[model samples]
Target: MTSDAPHSLPDTLFDTAVVAGVGLIGGSLALGLRQRGLVRRLIGYDASYDVLREAEALGVVDEIKTKPGEWLREAELVVLAAPVRVLPALARELAPFLNPAALVTDVGSVKSGIAAELEALGVRNFVPGHPMAGSERGGVTHARAALLENAVWVLTPTDHTPLTALSRVRTLVEELGAAPVVMPPDAHDSLVATVSHLPYLASLALTHLVARDERLSLLAAGGFRDLTRVASGDPRMSRDMVVANRAALREALLRFRRQLERLEADLEDPEELLAAAQEGKRTRDSLPVVKRSLLPQKHDLVVAMPDRPNQIGRVTQALGAAGVNIKDIEVLAIREEGGALRLGLESVEAVARAAELLTQEGFEVRSRR
Candidate 1:
């Protein structure tokens, strides 16, 4: 079932895709890929035979196999949608059986470790991806086709990675209605440690703090439930994330502690506490309103811009003057010389017009939608 050439992919990408670990992420990916006609046959493998059978029954996978390695022979793309801790071993097992040119990827939360391990295994086509999408709910039974829609899918590709392979994986991700963001392995880990892993840890701690009070549990309402919701996620997955990104997580934890200490210090004085609370509300209220765009009628138009003073204001002014109102503007990155800006608009035409106007103003702009 191996592909003959080392550079070619199957004609129809959705014709066959093999997913290891038919749990929530894997099952959802399979279903989404199928619904979008990205693949015709979706084969799945999981440690739990019962879950595998259920995936098959629910049409999450066209076929379910007990041995994941067996399916790799025929799969054009192999997605390792397992826990962070199990990624290394899974890569090892799949490395020996994978089609030489098959684009291999994963949905692991952390990337550096797995990327290094797979690179060492001679898997040059490996693309370590992490979809910044998930719910507190766990297991294959909760899988939904729309889980990845409008979500961010980050790809960490090494220098040795083939461009074609990366593009293939990007297409697959996009077909499932997810955006593919490329970043360095270390950057991916560091970013997720702050945004995902650290938050999960904080949620766990918050839950523990409240769980100790019997009265609090009895009177628990929406705010407490909302804050501690992530604590209900799979304990094993949460533990693995903390361990995998320990260094970054430690830094995040320290910063969090410092913030907490500042809050505690303020609480010692009534006026100080009230002022601090007011400041929090003021800052929160000042956040840009995320309105639905009337012009760019689409997801978002991402553009790269020079990191100069007044660059953002200039771009907004240009669009605003042209009657192309921006729904939301986000600065995704700020490098030494340039930055990436993501503009949420209601129409693609508005984005094109904005790009033209920015270009005319002697600024570089590129569509990143």
Candidate 2:
């Protein structure tokens, strides 16, 4: 919706848009299309009559269909906004109902399995898409029209996928204020399995384990709660996700387990533990920063400090001397001699200069990209 998006919107609008599920993603997308004036009419279909009714009452759809065939037949743009396990089956069901030229896309997280299923169904009009946007909460009641803004909507187009289908989906994603990323189906599945699936499973494991310990439950604070927040997501959907992407998720789990094992092994050795923590800081620093807001930019710099008075002053002073503007600074990971200092800089160039200055002052600094 903004002028700064990488993709430009098509002046041509959809005549009839059909959303297959009235959950968080489906509802949010419907709201987005309505707000953008990209669709003349919106129709929704859901397994739950109550949810469908609610979606209609919320103005998410102009029409609600009791059966898939009733509405999907008229759609110029069909969004299969359902679970990954259900998408393949839904695609099969949607086959006879699809308009010869209708563009079908999905919000399912994993893609390879669904892509294969759709490929076998001979659905060339469908483009497999995974929008990297969500919260722990589920359902349309918690959905917001702005949910997809600035989020990455990955389109996994197999060799069978038609170029027109992919283009239509990308335009829709842009109209909804999301960045559309293109990749192969298998690559999308493997990458998301680690970043998305693994985190949810880890949250599930931690929360369930802690809930069993009465004392731990009573004492669990911000850190524990924050780390396991995704466990509060819809359990049925979470279970479906892990089960659907078993092989990729399994590999990711193994890799994460190995790292945790190493961390556990060094718990007794403070020096090794600190070294591992520093290495983690560096690795995590190199990762792309998660976009939080469209405005108020801030770059985070993690600096290793020796335990001594005026360490914070030293770091900030160095940046100030280098003509770098730092927004804020905090102390973290206090050790015997020094600890880590987290600095917030105004811009990307400022971040580089601050890192250079701090390193010259004999401080180990890491920049979170």
Candidate 3:
């Protein structure tokens, strides 16, 4: 067994973490924990030993354990990154081996069922979490280090969840550069049903309809490709998500059916349908390409700076120390070696002051707007 204390993670909250199921989420979390210095040691366990070996070789895990019980005994944190269907059984399997104080969390999209199952198994420290981020592709090979960066990670902790355990899980998420949003289990399921499950179902339906049309398949262009792109997601995963959130998904489908019926009714009158389509196009076009918070707000000054370390903090500190409140800020580009940073502020006065201060601090800052 490896010691928990490592020089890389001096302020680490969790000494050791075991990621169950070395798929995309598991592999990505292992990589993030190591890169961000969040944990001293990270180990992985998956049913596929070959994938586990591959993950270890790829540096996603420090070690691979075929026996989860052996690793769970030593882990301070255990993250269940398995499929939604396998989660309840996996929880039951690990329940006996888990330490009394160990923090258990899962990356499953559905929460209510898993929460109830864990509770029934006498797992009190479990905190259900779902990082609202993923790619259409699956597997550990597709796991990227920045998979969770700037993404909203939701934690649905039931009344039985320990406060300390939830806090530790939140810290782990933030360490991976994700923003943590707390919500009730049912609320999370309902919201995901509309925003995520419905979209997946729509994409699948759209893809099936297009595939059935011999002419449409041959002539499908960018628009069709873009709209049906998410249909390429792992079929098994999509099926599980739909089944898990069936109630909320049924509600969303009903609402979608009503909208489709309205459109069909309008199509009976060609002129009215055309006018409605035109109006829809106009409304979509009128919407701002980028949000105001993402872009510069009205009457705000936007400054562009080089992508140097401490450049943003320096500018913000200077403005903040001088009692200047930043209305908005956007990091436009960092793809190049000396890429520029964009800062947006409420007033021209703040911009002028910030620019002067940044220049005095020996940095290149320019006013973009």
Candidate 4:
């Protein structure tokens, strides 16, 4: 991923930065940059005037431009946050207005095609990027600076990319509290296909499989809800993402099919089925708890709270007040009058501290490491 080209530009603050398509990702990036004082002035452009206005009203940007023009000339950094399908056209449209020294990047999930296209279009400073963070919720209204905290941000620079441009982008990403990773565009797309794209498709398929079953609603519980949560994301956005990376996604689907076939064949053998289940459990448990930690050993606690208003809020607030940073959280075994909340903490000491705090608040807690 390293380029041999020399980077002559001195490190400096960006006086003017531009963000196109200020939706969730764009709005979040704008908020993160502005909150950190990384840019002197932030300008936003979007196809929807309503979005742009809302973004400005929310203090996500300093100015909102409905279309590209001379204002782009002042921008030292430009982030393209549009959907996967429209990124190429958006880059092409904004190319002429951009100054020669400006650095360009994007939040588009599919990068291989866009990277090649931007390079061919003579966008020399373009460094293709995709942030591994977001929610099922969409739109600028859902945008928050904390959404990107500790997230993995992948940067795929073309052969023509200058080392200076990559360094500047990487610095900005770090300032925004995200971990920056460099890789080839094709490799990035291929890796995300199995982990990101394939999971969304699986969620969609599972939801569709049970959509028409009238009896499933009452039977559906936390597990079902968790498994299909991605299906509830913006449909048009999901469609664009999957379609844009169809080739890699197709290969991922084939690999997944083979796994399912093997699982089916092992169903008749109890030992084989148990072994498969154990392997899955081990693998899932071994995944790093903290996104920034390569080899994390997470400590978990299950807190049971009575069904009451503000119970969940109280628990989290108590931990937050104590500076107990929770690595992850999930609701489990929800009942009509009560429920269990599983919290993942970074260290055993933190887990002990959290458990003690919650217990002092009269909540039942169990710790597992």
Off by over 4 Å in 3: 1-10, 265-369
Regions of model 1 farther than 4 Å from truth: 1-11, 68-71, 268-369
Local distance difference test, candidate 3: 0.79
Task: Give the top-scoring candidate (TM-score).
Answer: 4
TM-score of each: 0.73, 0.74, 0.72, 0.76
TM-score of 3: 0.72
Residues 132-223, model 1: lDDT tens digits: 78877878899998888767789988877765566667767766777677788899888888778888888887787777688988667688
| Alpha-carbon lDDT of model 1 | 0.79
Over 249-351, each residue of candidate 4 has an lDDT whose tens digit, in order, gives 9999999999999999998988998999999999999876546666344588888878788888998999999999988875543343566677989889999
Off by over 4 Å in 2: 1-12, 268-272, 285-369
- In terms of lDDT, which candidate is stronger, 2 or 3? 2
Worst 10 residues of 4 by lDDT: 1-10
Q: lDDT by residue for model 3 over 1-369, one digit each (tens)?
A: 112111123456678888998899888888888888778899898888999989988999998887756558788889999999999988887889998888899999998999899989988789999987788777889887788776778999888876556656776786787767778799899889987899989988888887878798877768888988778888888899899999989998999899789889988889988988999899878754422243324343334456567767877887788887776664433233443445666677777887777677666666753
Residue 9 in model 2: lDDT: 48
Alpha-carbon RMSD, each predicted model: 7.5, 14.2, 10.9, 16.3
Q: Give Cα distance to truth, residue 21, candidate 1, Å.
A: 0.7
Clashes of 1: 9
lDDT of each: 0.79, 0.81, 0.79, 0.85
Question: Candidate 3: worst 10 consecutive residues by lDDT?
Answer: 1-10
